[model samples]
Target: MNTPLNLAALVLALSAALTSAPALAHGEAHAGAQAQEVVKEQKPWGIAGDADQVDRTIEVSMTDQMRFIPDRIEVKLGETIRFVHRNQGRVLHEFVLGTKQDLDEHAAMMVKFPGMEHDEPYMAHVGPGKREEIVWTFNRAGEFDFACLIAGHYQAGMVGKISVSPTN
Candidate 1:
């Protein structure tokens, strides 16, 4: 009788342990889920700068063959540029300014979102035959590439360079 009671007690304890193990594991996973929620809540809307205080103006034209007419733009550091970008192409085009690596990364991200576009602080876009404007200030002097993020556009030579020189 004593041995039977001991076995029954041990079996009950083992069953309880098995049941509680999953609950504890689930609790840990729930904490991880809450942490992820917090992280997502803290995510930022990546747009930068206000559109006031434009210093200089520029006119850029895009052609039907996916090309920028002036492949090189010259600017001075700390100068504000008001860009008039026009897309004369049959398809859509974007005038984006960034480093080569930035353009590559942006192009990769752009490929993932069909019909979704990202206009950076220093960039703008105008549909076919339409014109858009953007005013941005170049704080640093560097060689930045301007490219159209539409599919296969950059590869087809829809890219240009902006040379920002030091203010003398």
Candidate 2:
């Protein structure tokens, strides 16, 4: 094959590998370990919940400009909410729930491993014009955070806030 054709094949192979490597790398074993940790204690972010038990559903949009419409959200404590994520942009996006510190750390890791893929109850990875969902229970009464920790997406302002008001 000519040099140009060889380079083209290599580029295509690398692209495919980058896109699917994270899913193939993180499997059931990884989820099992995360689940075990979740049972140990609740993180500051929030906890995953059953979809059928959700108290309400919120529609969120991830746009090409790296922004989440309604960047700030309010929720009641102990309420389970279903997030309908729509990637109405031209690039890949994600909705990940975490605290400021948690998101910062995760974002840094994502920068290091651009191909990393993770499936968490507080997260939804959506392709352009695609939709995804996340069901979570805001059991704690504190402020939390969510972001699209995909490479430079978070830094590009694709972040949101969740205020969990204390219940009576």
Candidate 3:
């Protein structure tokens, strides 16, 4: 029973258990852990803004039609925006902000793991007839994307754009 083959099997089992511990502790599974961890770092789109320093507040409404009312938003670079999200639909929705590439990757992950839960400063999850808000400082000047990455939502055209213009 103490053969080399048995020892190798035991080592592999232990290695998998050890590696999965952290992911379970964080309530994230596999690739989901990587996605949430990436959100904690600074993104090229911008960083989380302080609520007290909010330059303006924009109200966004989500509906069952798989759309965000006023899907286009423009802001000046370095402006802090408090985005108030209202879910007017009969189902759940989420607003996630990131670069187009990041959004695309995250959306794909969402398709694979529909139950994955991630709470970042750039994301607001709202249930039916619920309200949520996220404050973000657009310090970069470029075109970014915001979307509802709940399984099929993103693919249903539930996406928005944010244009950050360089400050004069």
lDDT of 2 at 135: 75
The C-alpha lDDT values of all candidates are 0.66, 0.79, 0.84
Residue-by-residue lDDT tens digits, candidate 3, 1-168: 679999999999999998876533112222233244324456799998877999999999999999999899999999999999999999988898998899999999988887775567788887789787778899889999999988889999999999999988
Candidate 1: segments with Cα more than 4 A from true spot: 1-52
Model 1 pairs in collision? none
TM-score of structure candidate 3: 0.76
**Candidate 1 per-residue lDDT over residues 17-101, each given as its tens digit:** 9887544221123222322221211112112223476667788999878889788999887777877787787666678777888
**For model 2, how does the per-residue alpha-carbon lDDT over 1-168 read when each residue is reduced to its tens digit?**
499999999999999988874343322222333334333236786688776799999999989888999899999999999999988988878888889998999999988987674556666777778787777888888889989888888898889999999887
Q: Candidate 2 clashing pairs?
A: none
Scanning candidate 1 in windows of ten residues, the lowest lDDT window is: 37-46
Off by over 4 Å in 2: 1-41
**CA shift of 70, model 1, Å:** 1.1
Ranking by lDDT: 3, 2, 1
TM-score of each: 0.66, 0.76, 0.76
How many times do residue backbones clash in model 2?
A: 0
By lDDT, the better pick of 1 and 3 is 3
